[model samples]
Target: MTDQISDAQFTARTLSEALPYIQRYAGKTIVVKYGGHAMVDERLSAIFARDVVLLKTLGINVVIVHGGGPQIGKLLDRLGIVSEFKGGLRVTDEATMEVVEMVLSGPINKSIVRAINQAGGKAVGLSGSDGNLIQAEKAQKTERDPDSHIEQVLDLGFVGEPSAVDTSVLDALLKSNSQLIPVVAPVGVGKDGHRYNVNADTSAGALAAALGASRLFLLTDVAGVLDKNKNLMREIAVDAIPDLIADGTAAGGMIPKLETAAQSVKHGVGAAVILDGRAPHALLMELFTEHGAGTLIS
Candidate 1:
């Protein structure tokens, strides 16, 4: 019938469209910063796992960095702990640090690892503390009084930034024929023997720089960067980010994402993308199709 014929034609076109992308990305390393809506939706979660497995099967190395903000918030609420944020950074005191570790490392990281395994890929769950992978220092807090002063030092109990990253451990994992996919949680320790919660995006950016990855993909809830007309802008130069931020088009969390993308490009990574994670097979569509779905910040 006519309906059956339409379905067949669509299937053929879809497969043809995907062929070039599979060929292009095969054998290259892709670092996927996996979070946002895709992680919360069960069907989307399975699809994401399948996409990673397929990439591995085709010989593309995948490194996954995940965020657990929602999960941490949920747990904090359950425990009757109130969270405070300064400049969008969670002010992590001692008690909050405990919950951060428990949620990020225990349930969330392991769940992703399990999904990848169930989807038939080899996955390893790692924290920044593992193999001394991420060495961090206590992030210096800023005091905003009448005069913004760095002299007023407030301790954001366990918020740390990556001062150093050793890629040797990651290299060894990738070299094995097992096609190991690393699922990393951003929790690092400082020289002063304190645990700190690093922003997952920052951690992933640093990892991409350290590993010199071919692509760094940040999966979020939006459909890439929009122009004044609200149309998705496919390609954007790194220098334009400042204007976008200043013009109020790129505000809120997108600012940090743009900052990370700029840092990645500056440090020798090929490209960084901010793609909508809600779209099914969004990863494959972005990587393989000529018209990608998210903002490609080069």
Candidate 2:
């Protein structure tokens, strides 16, 4: 009986802690970049779907941008195609582009949409090509080995960087229905009349910037950014980003993620958070609890 009473008290405290955040972000837009382990795990996926629904129910506008790297890789293997990456960007040729489109738009997007719907959220799945929502340009070839005196250009074919975003479609959807949530697959159409694969984090950052979102959340597998001691850093200012990158703390795949976060903050997004998607109720904890569970970049 005492244990049951404690549990009830804990639940009440949790709800009380969340009240401020719910009030603060009501009617504000939050762009969530959903990827990493959470996307593949059925349990985490359901939790994520429910979290999005809860946010919507509390009057927050939620936009999800998702990745399909593992799925794409599996498809490529099945098709007997070899895949490579240049500067962490997939070297997407014509054949690979076809598979990317199929995987991202067909199964992954629909699955997320279904999950959200099941959780009582009205979700519409879309690609960047839908309604010309995201306009992208081919990423220019970069010099591969500058130190080796090799001015060779490496072309990551069909890999695009978002050049512009038309938020009119999103606005229309939001205005037409208050409960509408957009689940975007990071596949865009290029000016060259070709389908291009955009990085999900990059797409989310650009969308946040375009919409002037109040918050941008990057849900990854890890426990957010760490210092030299591997301790999670709670907050980072935009000015310190260069130092972090220079000291090798933010290298490899984390570089792009941090860069996107900094860029979003610089471009007028209120704040960007890197949260562990594997944590149960991580979204709620990060958004509502006093001692949040991730790194906040502003």
Candidate 3:
């Protein structure tokens, strides 16, 4: 933190320079997806919580959608529950879905809420099931067997994607209430009253789109979307993501994040950025500085 900026004078200058940005985003919504390395590292988590509190203090309506994959996996291991994956998505059955909900909505969600509250902000933890914030349907996919060369359906039990989202809960929270931040777990409820495990990044993107949020920030481990040489591409047009994915530049978990970011931007989100959550105050750097902190896809 000390090295990022020179000294106190620079800090003061940064605050002075950020007045316009502060004003520009005041009363606007920003949805932050908190996960990856940031969720694990104690120091990073504390920093992120403070950053969120600061954003709210500045009148930026912040909605946090958080992921707890590693935590869930850890607990599942403890319980001796077998976990599986199809493509990059988790294959969540009924038993695994129970663990997902327990860890995500119970401990992890409240922990984040507590962190923000301890940092002097009012935060309410929620799941997508609360108020039917997200209506989910089973996610579908197909893949070809290498030897058979025939595509077959891959059934990931209980896993879902966002079918619809209701923002009445958010409107009541963000617009009609006191100064509050929402920390949401990615768990969703199906129309048939079944619980579905939704991917956090996908859920966050969908929520951002539904709210017409000013910015959707996906804070992850990497610097941002990189090129073939792994150089960070500072700014990207939404249309260019397919080429990057096709050329194999975006792979693994990053592919979903890129796809989500592009889709959010297309769905009327003001801006979507993939940035390193490992860095201290990374959100502040991106929002307030001239040279931002990550790859911004507008």
The reply for model 3, stretches above 4 Å from the true place, is 1-6
Assess each prediction's global lDDT (C-alpha) against the native: 0.89, 0.91, 0.92
lDDT of 1 at 121: 91
RMSD to native, candidate 1: 2.2
Top lDDT model = 3
For 56-75, candidate 2 gives per-residue lDDT tens digits of: 98888999999989999988
Candidate 1 C-alpha lDDT tens digits along 1-298: 9999999999999888888778887777888899999998999999999999988998889999999999999999999999888755789999999999999999999999999999999899999888777789988877665565445566677899999887777888888475899999998877766778999998999999888888999999999888888989898999999999999888888899999999998998889999999999998888878888799999
- The order by descending lDDT is 3, 2, 1
Worst lDDT run of 10 residues, candidate 2, spans 169-178
Mind sharing the TM-score for model 3? 0.96
Model 3 global lDDT (CA atoms, 0 to 1): 0.92
TM-score of each: 0.92, 0.96, 0.96
TM-score-sorted candidate list, best first: 2, 3, 1
Residue pairs whose backbone atoms clash in candidate 1:
21-288, 158-196
How badly does each model clash, as a count of residue pairs? 2, 0, 0
Residues 1-298, candidate 3, lDDT per residue (tens digit)? 7766678778798799999989988889999999998987888888999989999989899999999988999999999998888765678998999999999999999989998998899999899999999899998888888899999899999999999999889888898446889999999989998999998999999999999999999999999988888899999999988988888988888888999999999999999999999899999999988889999998
Clashes of 3: 0
